[model samples]
Target chain A: MLEIKNLHVKLEDEDKQILKGVDLTVPAGEVHAIMGPNGSGKSTLSYVLSGRDGYAVTAGEAALDGQSLLEMEPEQRAAAGLFLAFQYPVEIPGVGNMTFLRTAVNAQRKARGEEELSAAEFLKLIRQKAATLKIDSEMLKRAVNVGFSGGEKKRNEILQMAMLEPSMCILDETDSGLDVDAMRLVADGVNALRRPDRSFLVITHYQRLLDHIRPDVVHIMADGRIVRSGGPELALEVEQNGYGDLLAEVG
Target chain B: MADTAVLVAQVPTVEGKVRPGQAALAAHLDALDLPRGGFSRAARQDAAQRLEAMGLPGARDEYWRYTDPAPFNAARPEPLEFAADDATLFTAIDRLHLVFVDGRFDAAASDPLTAEGVEIESLAAADAGDDHWASGLYGRLEAAGQVPVKRPFAALNTLAAADGLLIRVTGQVARPVHITYRRSALDADVHLHHVVKLEEGAELTLLESGVLGARSNVVIEADLARGARLHHLSAKRAKDPKLGLGHIFARVGAEALFKSFTLSVNGAMMRNEAVIDIAGDDAVAHIAAAVLGDGNIGRFHHDDTVFVIHGAERCESRQVFKKVLKNGAEGIFQGKILVKPGAQKTDGYQISQGLLLDEGSQFLAKPELEIYADDVKCSHGSTTGALDETALFYLRSRGVPRERAIVLLVLSFLADALDEIEDTRLREDILGRLEDWLTERAGNPGKA
Candidate 1:
């Protein structure tokens, strides 16, 4: 349901290219994993797809459900069923989590000409979703991610994805700082949210996360380009042999 | 007349007779048929004399350097005349009320509080007693000795003040007193001299809400006694297309606690000045203020000044000021904390922060700390910045529109100061008004 063809992006007001001719596609009912070393443009790809400012798309197009995602604003893209779980979720000091989530959900609903949910209805829906994710009700009353722990912040990202229920999800480094237990919980939350019509592109540095959320396809990214594509066995190979061998093979 | 004469005698002669402009102001004061020896008469005269000697505050004055009062000179204000029908402005708040129209007390509208040992009388009636604190404390904490007066509007308030409120809590009264100042017509000026004396171990809460017309000026002076605690909240709402000016002076005694909260929104031209003196040792003072201005509307200006005297050791003082300027509006803050030589172990902290929503919006912050004591912990900081782009993006990506996200950010920026207020009703009331102001701006762009 999501496609990025020959994508080339550079930092605004600078000549340094961050994403060079990157091609990726995730069709309906399939999960893809993009594993890469440091500075391999994984986070840049997510930011560019999510329409963050300061990242200029010099070439190529990113489409979601056959609609041009690059032309939409950040809010519009989210409404169009595109979700990016940020590596570093921002702390919105005064905006409570419930208020922020409700605003987001209702904005997307209104954009699609659907009736808005009342406060009671929203509370009921969010409670059910949060229960499956193991998020406490008290955390919903606080300012969004103001003082959340690393595991809690990542779990919050999954909670948001479950609430938004996007058709296309991009998990950026979801397992980077998580402990074994947190990683397991987060992967479980993601697995519960998966559906036949939804697709996910899980980006990470290690193969430990691959053991929990088994991907149908795995791709190796380096120097702003995807150089290798294979089955999930490639992830196991990379864990044993490391990226040093893959770098030489790609060269 | 005797009250005026006593005021003139107490007036320092360092600068001799009042200047021409001050003479005009004094003439305006002479026009008011105020009762003799009222709360503010002598203080008004003394302040007028000081303003005359100091001359009008100009850009050269360090405090008045950033904000120029020249725009207020377009319209000349006449002596305030009491209006019988000006009581409509008090409808928004429901409390035991005391109404002051055109700087004179209105007994018909005020509900007398007659708790045992607690006296809530008019300044005119209170002055008849031997223990009147008005004459003893008015204008005692003004910074005219150092900073001097350069603003013409403040000079006018000094010259025009008349009747006020005197609240005396004897043997520890528990209930709160709400003082409401309502401005009716344009070009109208009112001055209030409020004296709150808490006997040893007495506690009181005073909420001051000022509602002004297009062109209005108000000045208030207050005092607290030993071992007594007082919490004061002042909210100013001015929507007139003309000028609006406000000034406040207060003093606290030894071992006493004083807290103040100020909120100002929608004024063609507005200024709220607070000068506080911690006269007694072991006394504590806390001051917090929040101001929001729309750059597209009439110019909105705020000048807040604080003075702390460490008369006794181990005194504590804290000040926090936050301002939000949207559109092309301007926000200004000036705060100073002083620790005396013998006042060792004094703890003082001051912080001023401003958020500019648009490029045309402007904010100027000046925070200063002056210490003479060697064993003191004092620090001051000032910051002016725009909304965080990353925070904004995070909210927008979650489906919140840009405008709603901005409002949330602005409210978060001010929550720190608002949380410091102790009165739940007053805090909620201020928050409601802030939401109303934000809603109005959000609904109608360029119509501040």
Candidate 2:
């Protein structure tokens, strides 16, 4: 469902290159976890796929469902079924979470040439999805992520993911600021949406998050490239001994 | 009191001290004629003397440096085509309607000047006889407001007003008095003065809207007694580019509450000044403004100048001003909060912000605070910036279009300024008008 070939990305303002040359692919109905240490370009990969600014994709290509992602705008990428869960969700003051979600839902539907959901339908849908994530109505009515706790922010991101229901989702360090309970809740929310036609690329720094989600494939990424690919046990191995030993052995 | 008589003498004298601004002001004032205008003679003459002493604003003056006073000082304004539309605001709510056309009171178009618990009369029709209530308030607050700053335009307006409204509230008025202005003549220059007086334990709500004319100079003076409450809401809508200069002079007594807000949309040049003085203990005053200017449409330049003074203990004042400018439009805000001696526990907060939609737009703000009392909390902040790029990208990444995201963000940025409105319905009405302005120019993000 997602493909990247020799993807090279660099900061637009500096001479530093982040993603030198990376190759990866996730088939349909599969859940893949990318465990990387600091400066390994895991977050950059997600941002590049999501069409965020401040980065120049110097070489190679990334695609979602056979559609090129680099050429599309961020909103276009979303309509093309590409979702990126931010490491730190932005705090947008004065914009209610419910309004933001509704706007996004209708926008995607309009882009796909589908009928827009009515107000009542949207309220019902969001209420059901939000209840599962423990996001009450008061939280939904407040400003988007403003004054929200770290756990609440992550859960809000998960709620957005559920609302959008994209074909391919990238969770970029979603567990960084979450506690064990919050991680479990986020995992449960993600697990509930695991469908046969959908795919997930979970980017994390530790094996704790993968313990709950139970990825089908685990990839150890170091220095802008994936060094090893194996079953979920690869994460357990990294947790036992850090990436230093694995990188030294590979070297 | 700067020797208003000696400054402009009918006959020249070798010992006369000629102020620099008065010569050009006298020359400008020469082309116009004065009249009685059906107002209290003493009040009109007092205002006229004040204007003569201070003179009109000049570009080189310190206070007028940011905003050009040429449009306001011109003897004759360039005529504009009158905008003939029936979309006068405040029609959805029940209100006592009073209409004015080109600064002239339109009796045929206005509702009867009779409401329970309130006394409303046309200033031009009311006889300025002895013991008249208006005689005490015609320009009293205005004269007091001019001590620290010279509002020559307001002084000129008081003397040249063609018509006005005199409203006296003794009890809680059940309905708001809505004053709407309409311009029929293209070259019409309108001058209007309104006064509202609230007695002790009284309450009132005033709603003002519409276009005055090609050029308009207006002033409204409000006096609130102890335990009185006043809510003043006004929205200026001018389809045709015009010149508008307005001022609100208020005297808030002890334990009184005064709140005023204005929403300015389009104009070639517009300036609104508010001067509020709280003399009684435990009084509360808040003045806010939201301006949207698009120079590409008609050379937009909007200015809001506010002065709030606290003279009694435990008084609180707040000033919130926000402006959104695009297409080379310029927005200016000059706000000051002054706490006098013995005014302990004075809580003052002021925030002035500008959101420029593009590089061509500009926002200039000067926020000032002066404190004399030892125990007080006074804080002021000013900011000018483009929309939050990260927030915009976040919204876009969630599948919302870039333009739609921008509109939403703009509305959110303006929501803070609108929060000062206590009435939910009036706030929503103003918010809806602001949203329409943003949506009309949604595609013009002025960025890549």
- Isolated chain A TM-score, each model: 0.98, 0.98
Candidate 2 lDDT over residue span B173-281, tens digit each: 9889999988878877888889999999899999998888889888999999999999999988665578988999999999999999998886558988999999999
List lDDT for all candidates, in order: 0.75, 0.88
Off by over 4 Å in 1: B1-41, B71-94, B99-118, B121-133, B138-158, B171-176, B179-181
Residue-level lDDT of model 1, residues A24-129, one tens digit each, is 8899878999998999899889888887888998899989999998888888898888899988888887668998899899988998889999999999999999
Q: lDDT per residue, candidate 1, B1-448, as tens digits?
A: 9999999999778577555444544555555443445444676567656666655554455666767755443335532332332223224555567766555577787766566556776765665655555556545544342343344555555454455666777665555566666665645544455556677767877776655434556555556677888787777665544455666665678888888888777554566666667778788988898888775665566666555555568888888888888777777777778777788889998888888888887778777777888999998888899999988888778777777778778888998788768877677777767776686678788873
**Tens-digit lDDT track of model 2 for A3-54:** 9999999999998899988899999889999998999999888889999999
Worst 10 residues of 2 chain B by lDDT: B439-448
Candidate 2: Cα lDDT at B423? 93
Q: Give the TM-score of candidate 2 (chain A).
A: 0.98
User: Model 1: clashing residue pairs?
Assistant: B56-B150, B57-B150, B57-B151, B254-B280, B281-B312, B295-B328, B295-B329
Candidate whose lDDT is highest: 2
